[model samples]
Target: MDAEVGGTSAEEDYKPESWYKVKKGGKAVPMQREERQPEVSGAATQERPNHFKRAAGKKLAEKSVGKQHVRIPDGATRIILRPQGGLAPLTRLGAARLLYYVCKETGIFYGDARRDILSPNEALQTLLIATEDKKRAEKYQQIASITTEEGSKTEIKAHMTIPESRGKGVIHNVHLSVSDAEL
Candidate 1:
């Protein structure tokens, strides 16, 4: 706590003057009550009362490591695809081909689905694989969307920055569980 008396410094304000002096002998004896200054604003204030989370939240705000948490709406069923590991970013033409490859590999009808694999955050952000059927989308989520580079056998699977773990961090039945993947 701070007692601001018309713009006084902290050190001057922290120490309170003696209220009165009592005379005991020929020479006057001054009686003063001393008080310990409380930690008002600084690291010590948080450490004393366990305001640890504030410091953690401040640190988190300072260093934003990656993209904001990607959340898809729940009105539709969709599977999110993101390039995994050190795989090179797919060009627009390559993205289109990969979308087709994923649909073909997953046994989904190309007509019933819609994809946006070459969006603004193509390399980091997730591209969605959506269909009218919820079960098919869920099934596709289970299967890893993989593709090989043009010449070499560089097998890449579609994964994402954040794992699809929700509800107590337990892996539940896909049919009954909820995830951040639905679009």
Candidate 2:
């Protein structure tokens, strides 16, 4: 009988090799041809940006000279009142009454501003300002003493505190190593 494939006699296709005629790699195991690894002709890794050096410019070194961001100062100024004999803690109503007296004297510091006068922590010792006229607010700088409703004289101190350089969005790149050398 003619061994034909796809309606064609096998004799026309003279490829005489058969599966059984092929060479065996032993134990019917599939085998792969030995392949030589490609030659190492150049660097296998890339040189990335280092801390001291970058692709564009030098990093922000402490010695680097340049303009810095402008920071806004605190909005409200604080007033501290130290009585001749440290102020006795006052109740809320009594404190408000005391601030009323203070505002009566320094009407510029406390005005129509809702929070023009506030007793933040030291109800009897601190007077807060929320006035808008900052230029005129300097009048508070001249204030030295306050006479309370009881007519007791007290030394007055005022100051404004600012936040430290928060280092917002600051980044510092540390050296990394793949081997013994820093990269």
Candidate 3:
């Protein structure tokens, strides 16, 4: 068997023992052994742009820089509206409820209110923008004045009370006359 394996009996060729003895279909055949080459051993190669770094770059701290100072007009009363006492649902929901109330009080359309209520931050932003005109919508301070009820799920009950504008071309009387002491 050894003589036949080495090709001395006219079956195989003489070669080093390191050669492979591949068995196929119940028959042993001599085949050259494959030499293993050195592999690229280290971190896996990156195929895409610095995606990991880019993702981390987006996580950097955000900074806001600005100064806001308002000079109150003489004889103009300052009204400080307090946040209703209640079990505030997350800040987002509070914002939504606030927005819904503002739009309703301001006589905004239901569809517009719905859209604003969907995004509280945006609604609050809009409300802030709408209140910028002091002469039109002066802040009022009266116990009977509109306010939110206190409870776990507090809701808004404020009304938009704008001052009267004395001008002839003013075809619409959309202003309310609250006591100056309240303003």
Candidate 4:
């Protein structure tokens, strides 16, 4: 038992160590040197505080009074709507109606709505839709009146610019005729 224990101890002690021999006549040197990365300091080393930690002690001001009412500006008559991209005429008209109602209820101007309006994009689109609807309705009404008269023939001639998406160029001359029989 003593011999077996001595042999095991000797085996454990004989574990390999990496060493390099010096070229000029001398001793074995350790092949590996102990190395540590340089510690980073100052602003570069500091981590940014998380949002919750930064705002931990801050308290929002409480409202002392009820919310202030928005007032419409003086001398403002109509809201302007500018539609970008290719939107349908009906869509522009619908947007206009929605905006008209919103302005009426909120008592806010077009510029003010950017901040106060729940959805600014929807409001703008509503205004455009309303404008298109009005223009188209007026033109159709004029045509209807001419076609309604009894026992008479009428010709309506008009010129209008067609939208770019429809095709090239403005419609130069448009002519329509209606007789009592057709009506």
Candidate 5:
């Protein structure tokens, strides 16, 4: 192996010179130098990192609540919803009502009931899904009203009030065991 010395270039040494002869098996062998293309002039030799650009600048400042635009400052504020009872005791009708109201006011639709009482972070997962369905999301705002009206017409409260009546308590029972699909 050979290397460039001092100011000599890589090409100057890659080609065989008169002083040194290439040989194989104690016999002189013809060496074929591969042709190489010249680098482009003024071409950017330094690799640049890939950068992402958003053309819709400053438009991100405009906040959207469902389909409506809401103006707020660039600070964080927490809105608390205190359950009528402790979280554990929160029934499906109660949780759906609270969730409906929260979605109405905050423009965040978390869908319906959860088998487990979710923390704030887990609740945010529903928001990601909400982003896709803007119109249907508004339905969540009125879910409590629809549910209440339907329940009143069907005497749902009286039926659900019965203790340990599993199948009979449709709304309340489903609320306790509902999945992401219902949401």
Candidate 6:
């Protein structure tokens, strides 16, 4: 019989080799090949500004020297202090000086002056109050003391105290005070 007529030809029965082959244990393993990921260019890498950069920008803006002015809405009782000439950049000490002037002029005492008023260096304090009256200073101190005492008393009365057991194994009788129950 002729090869073309009686049976399949070599081209018709040919099978291409597979990329993977089955091992003796029946595990089909892939043939190893060299593969790599595409490289990224330096110019394509993007960077974001960090917290330091943002904070530096804010501080720079605040410290920019210029004519400082405050805009007050009509009918507002608050007095706005505006610097007549171009003011120097505000430093920590400068802020404290400004606060001192405001408090003196308005006769308003801001609580927690220790933090609000930067530690008054000798020169700054001298500049703050050129002349000091002993009577007035004493009166102000007395008022502050009275207010602090009253505030502490109220704060103490606001919280209720509960007696807790000293140890998990011991059961103790806790006597609640009249003030604690009222609270």
lDDT of every predicted structure (CA atoms): 0.53, 0.48, 0.39, 0.35, 0.34, 0.34
Query: Any runs in candidate 4 off by more than 4 Å, and if so which?
Result: 1-37, 42-44, 47-117, 121-183
Ten residues in sequence with the least summed lDDT for candidate 4: 144-153
Candidate 5 C-alpha lDDT tens digits along 18-47: 344457667765555557856755444322
Residue-level error in angstroms, candidate 6, position 176: 70
Candidate 4, 49-73: lDDT as tens digits: 4554555534322221222323433
Question: For candidate 1, lDDT tens digit of each residue in 1-183?
Answer: 555667974554454454456565656555576667785888777576566777788789866644453455444455555545433444443656666666666776765545322232444545555444666666567656455455322233443223235334555566645555751
TM-score of each: 0.36, 0.36, 0.28, 0.15, 0.17, 0.21
Preferred candidate (TM-score higher): 1 or 4? 1
What is the TM-score (0 to 1) of candidate 5? Answer: 0.17
User: Evaluated with lDDT, which candidate comes out highest?
Assistant: 1
Candidate 1 residue pairs that clash: none
Candidate 4: the clashing residue pairs are 92-128, 92-129, 93-129, 93-130, 95-125, 95-126, 95-127, 96-126, 96-127
Q: After superposition, how far is residue 87 of candidate 5 from its true place, in Å?
A: 1.0
lDDT of 4: 0.35
lDDT of 2: 0.48
RMSD per model, one decimal: 14.9, 25.8, 22.2, 21.4, 18.4, 21.3
Which regions of candidate 2 fall more than 4 Å away from where they truly are? 1-74, 79-84, 89-93, 109-114, 123-127, 163-183
TM-score of 6: 0.21
User: Clashing residue pairs in candidate 3, if any?
Assistant: none
- Indicate the residue-level lDDT of 27 in model 6: 98
Residue-wise C-alpha lDDT for candidate 6, range 52-161, written one tens digit per residue: 67788888887663323333233222211222211222223365555544344335464433222222223222111111333333322322111121232111011111
